[model samples]
Target: MGIPLSPRPARVIDLETMRQRQQARKRLIRLAPELDGLEMVYHLPSESDAYYGMPLLAWGLREDGEVVGLVPWMERLTPCQSLEDPEHGHFIGYRDPETEELFEDPPDHKVTELEQAAAYFEYEATEEPTLIQQLPETQGTHALCMDDSGEPWQLKQVFGWRLYSDGAVEALLADERLIDSTPILPGDACLYPGHSRHRVVYFFQRQIANRIRREDPATLEALALMVMPADQEG
Candidate 1:
């Protein structure tokens, strides 16, 4: 048998919700280990040096499995982190990880339960994703995409490799789609699916938002707020 499954019931809680979410994420990290070294293909539209749309595929996959993604999503904060105490930044500068900048009187940021759940599903900025995914098996399929006529395209060479989690990734896709359209983790490097990191991140974040809205509406609002661009969130 694989890793023992965690119920992760959606009963809803109060303060302990954070602790519960963290526990769920930690447990997932230890469960599945097969996703390591996997690759997903991203197909972004190219219009003379400008990329448009987000079409994701898988690597080495000849297209036979079931497609599960194609949901435009965005999440502002991955690698969920808590805010430093008021004293910590008393007279110091802060660096915006996304922008990679330092600011005096930096805006405040904290890891909410919603963000934690996102990390649970897909870690941000870090290498490993699916640290808390319930499903361990990945298949290949057409899956839903922004602009797909469902026609087989000619797949070229591997242009990108594991570019989603770290930051911006660009890839050249040459059809056949992934093997069974397997489910790739967020961090899995492939082609840059969206035009910009900001847009892609938001799309994924929205994915998490939909999950919350279904399982727990209470989290949906805060999650929507947090997933906004850093400037907007601030």
Candidate 2:
């Protein structure tokens, strides 16, 4: 009698799958599941807030970081909201399909600001460009520091770069009128420069503006980047 050989067993690959597991989380998906391998994140523009167009896209990760359960996602079964009557329901299939009764009721004011803001932003972005009128760069506020030891120079505020919290200088350098260009927050700051560069001779408001003394150490480095330097201008 001869012994028969068996084929290798099939391997079960483990994939961290992220899916909408519950009704509450259907709109707000988990964030950054790929760090743990949850890659099966399904998303679309519609899953986001109906008013603003911000993508509500994220991965739904499990405690163990694997796709193991089904929760409350109705996107596949019930898509699109009904606009037949604002009072009745905004999300169509969420309500009784036949009678148009809602599965849940949301306040009337919830959607107003989200919708209006989205529309306003779209208009500002897509509409015609706004040209900044400015006078000569030399005429604007001049500022500079020769070095760590040199006297800090300062004048009226310029219409060029404004030092932001994130160490960025957003340049809107072509206009006679000076404007405020500071970022609202550290994250809101620009990562790089704009179209133009203005070599400023800045006078420090304070007597000392050293790296250790200044609030934002990167400010000096950021301003230095915009300069062509007398040596590099040629």
Which lDDT values do the candidates have, in the order given? 0.29, 0.28
Candidate 2 Cα misplacement greater than 4 A, ranges? 1-118, 124-128, 131-231
Question: Which lDDT tens digits does candidate 1 get at residues 34-151?
Answer: 1222221222233234312222222110012111211112221111112122321111233334454544421222213223344465544345632222221232211111222333
Per-residue lDDT for 152 in model 2?
A: 44
Best model per lDDT: 1
Q: Supply every candidate's count of residue pairs whose N, Cα or C atoms clash at under 3 angstroms.
A: 34, 20
Worst 10 residues of 2 by lDDT: 69-78
**Top TM-score hit:** 1
The C-alpha local distance difference test score for the whole of candidate 1 amounts to 0.29
lDDT of 2 by residue, 1-234 (tens): 988989899987544333423322333111121121111122244445442111111222222322221111211111122122242223322222234343332223323433443335332222443321111112122233232223342222223333222212233222224323553222232321232333333332222234324546576565456333522542
TM-score of each: 0.21, 0.17
